[model samples]
Target: MDSSVSSLTQYGSFRKPTFPLSNSCRHKPRRWPLALRFIKGAIHHVILVPILLHTLFTCIIVYIHINIQTLSVPANIVPSLSIVVGLMLVFRNSSSYDRYWGGRTNLQSIGTSVRNLTRSFLVCGPDRDEADRKETEKVVKVLVGMLYAVKNHLRSTWGHGYLLPEYKGLLPEGMYGFESEGVGLVLELAVVVERYIKRGVDRGAFNAPQSSMLSSQLNALVDAYGKMETIKLTPIPIAHQIHQKQVLALYCCVLPFCLVDELGWLCVPIICLICFMLYGIEGIGEEIEDPFGSDKNDIKIDAIIEDLRQEVSVLLDSWRRGGEEYTI
Candidate 1:
């Protein structure tokens, strides 16, 4: 038992420290009470503006109907309006969700391609000589750099802020030919990888089939990059967005008028609840539509990038150990 414990301790000493998972499934739970949650979201500038306007309109309609007896909008009008507004909100949320899901899917594709290409380079490529090993290490660094660059590209952030500290020295000194630093860096890395492949083939380190597979993986990464760019640059139709907002605004502004005659003093709370629900739904769609941002609801891009880095590190370590060869 003592010998076993000693061995375990020795093994533990060489083990890497484990990090807490940061993906969606293991994210910190939100445990705020219902009242707190309501108050927290209620005070947001977006919701507050609509709530204040709703309250004002509710009070005005109540006074006018009870004291002056001058206004009465038919209650039947609400059913049709509610149906139309509900449908529009549904469409809006669905379209936004499509974009959010597409962004996530594309990012995953990029991550998969990065891992595949990195593994192919480190395990299958030529690492026979000291010079060959050095070149392979350089290529591995470039693979890691491409993942970070893609993350920054999606977020529309350029310059050094988004770069991984460990891989910074591996990248070129300045942005590549393109004006956009993130994209330019990725393109530059691709050029380097392609040239490395050509040199490997010329030196007979990798034959045609092996070189072709590596090139295909690189091509997959680029294809995923283009798809992500399309999602980022193209937005839902402006007309649809504008029209939905206009409808929502009109519905909220006129809502109290319809309720005041029936609910009297109770109309205020009812209107507040209805406005909150509708506004909250709309807000969710807006927040998620561009999932690459820093918002709580946005995709956890930093976490994803960190996972990619860890994956590449593991592959590099395996190569260094001369582990069982990995076939493409």
Candidate 2:
């Protein structure tokens, strides 16, 4: 079965997560052939229509200048448009990148909180008997579920039907149902974890100070959730987007006339290349603006959740073998 279809059936909605391209500057990367890079680039797939049209437009302008009429514009138009378009594209890309980086940092915070709280429960938690250890394990599993819930909420994949098999039967009876508001299920799971933290206090698993610390970690998880929600819901201003695109189109349309006077026929390829660069930069901003989506440039959220799951499992297994004396 197609992965998209399978995810839709199992989780109600699916955002197929792809690994993000590397941006590390610590070391240089192997350079691929220009042809291969062009073939594999996302810009080619998205900007093909506009590039072709721009190429044809450039050809028409060149033909008119050569044969029918000496149609031309002052060379000053090139640098003039270049400055305005350059500033707009720079601001657009910068703002979009800020949102992308913010989303990543908040996700890291959530993962850190989960690990801290789970470790506290397993090692410092009340593990006097088999039942206590079992309860701790259940709480760790709930932490995993919390991540999945957050993932679904960000993707707008609501409802209990989206719960995976591992997360099933974990929610309290009668609590699982359609989550119209999107955050209800995630909040419910947080409440469940909080209740267990309180139980640990009642059972003498944690002192007042320790209990307070556990609660603080839970608060951090909720804080990260709220931050992510803000990123997902709030978008860049529509007015700015409209004006920038208008200016970009205008610049591209006039560029050929400015260059046709000097370069003549050679201006065709030059204009095409310039169009590709300008449109490609704009397209990248558009793709990464909302980093939570399933775009090729969006964060690999599914992989992040799975990594947390495996880490929690490994910690719990080590604790079980060490009989709760595991301090890490």
State which candidate has the highest lDDT: 2
Candidates in order have lDDT scores of 0.77, 0.80
Best by TM-score: 1
Each candidate's root-mean-square deviation in Å?
Answer: 3.7, 9.0
Give lDDT tens digits, candidate 1, residues 1-328: 8866885585457657755343434556669865677544343556778877887888888888889885658888888889989999999899889988988898888888888877777766776788888788888877878887777777766655234464565564553446353245577788988999999898887899989988998898888878878878888789988998999989987777777878997998898888888988888777777788866677887788777776676567657766453212
Which ranges of candidate 2 are over 4 A from the true structure?
1-35, 39-41, 161-163, 166-178, 181-183, 322-328
Clashing pairs in 1: none
> How many pairs in model 2 have backbone atoms within 3 A of each other, for residues 3 or more apart or on separate chains, i.e. clashes?
0
Question: Model 1, stretches more than 4 Å misplaced?
Answer: 1-15, 19-30, 33-45, 161-167, 172-177, 180-183, 323-328
